[model samples]
Target: MNLQAVKILFLKDLFLSRRQLFAYFAAGLASSALTTIPNPTVSFVGFLLMITVAIASGIHLIGTLMLSESTDQTRLFVMSMPISLLDYSVGKIAVILTTYLIPWSAMFASSAILTFVLPTSKHGSFAVLPAIFLFLLCAFLIQLVTAVVSESVGWTISVMVGCNVGLNVFFMQLFASPEISAAAKSDSVSWPPVLIQLLTVELLIAAGALVTAFIAQTRKRDLV
Candidate 1:
């Protein structure tokens, strides 16, 4: 692999994505505003916003990749290069992480600020960290799945929105309840059960993406 070429491609992709960083900040600000709301019944709402922001940010990153490749005709150029497909994939993942870290970090910091400023009888700021991590992991995994399945921008966005909406609803209904909130506060929310559910869902989504990426890479020649 040509390390210099990879570096150039990485930088180019980063520059393209930098243009969308404003949208990310807007999402972070929106999440921060939601956190500032002093509704006791809606303490979990901030976490919901956090999860939604993470998913939206992931979708935006993936959509940017697909859009840039198509718009600049860079996909064919990258594929035509001598670099291995694995290297290409790694470069894309690197770009995704670099582009996403800003918003994800902002979400975390904003959540911390909200936790302090908002009126919550319960102290669960530490719990927010793990939940944010899980949300991002799930978002990326879902992005991989959508990228493999959707050939166009419309389809990709539709699928991501649908999947993310469904996941958000499920989490809010199942885990964001007052009962669960109370449990989380007391550390009585059986860690084993919560971990099992989170791990199970995340692993399933990630395994699906890994399988799709493997299949896509193996058939790259055919795809071309």
Candidate 2:
């Protein structure tokens, strides 16, 4: 792999997509703020906004940094360079993570802090936030894979529309179940195995999706 090429690609991508990056960060922070509101209706709106930001952020990055790269003149310029498939894939993955994860981490960390400091965990148990945040992270990774590997606008958008919002809703409902809520409320430290297992599965799927996307991108004969 050409480390220099990867570095160049990262800087170029970041520079090109800087505006979107800032917008996503601000939107995520706004969602976090709204989710902390004391009102029930407001809080629900915040929750939906958070889910929207999660999915929208991923889609925006995929379009500007990945999908758009293929259809525009920028991609041609990058391809003219001495970068290999591995270098290109690594650069794309690096930029996607950098662009998405930094803001995501900030929003998530703030939410976690507010959840405990303001004591707003749904069932009064802090464990619930981790489950919620992890699910979003996991979903974004799978969505990233869809966007990168498929490289088909229709397929990528279809998968995003079909899964991201629905999975978020399903996971929210799952955590709200009586069993999980009871366990979360009963013991803050010792969470139920079901929650733990779900978190583990999310992590595993995220890791697998990332690996799959990387391999698929590298194996391709062309960028698109």
Per-residue lDDT over 32-82 for candidate 1, one digit per residue giving the tens place of the 0 to 100 score: 677666774464576677677777778778877755576578777877867
The Cα local distance difference test for each model comes to 0.65, 0.78
Candidate 1 regions with alpha-carbon error over 4 angstroms: 1-4, 37-52, 112-121, 125-129, 148-155, 176-179, 187-192, 200-204, 207-215
Tens-digit lDDT string for candidate 2 (34-126): 878889899779878876787788878988888887777677777777888778878888899789886788777877677666655643465
Which segments of model 2 are wrong by more than 4 Å? 119-124
Top lDDT hit = 2
Error of 1 at 217 (Å): 1.4
What does candidate 1 score in Cα RMSD to the true structure? 4.0
TM-score for model 1? Answer: 0.71
Judged by TM-score, which candidate is best? 2
Steric collisions counted per model: 0, 0
In angstroms, give how far residue 175 of model 1 lies from its true place: 2.6
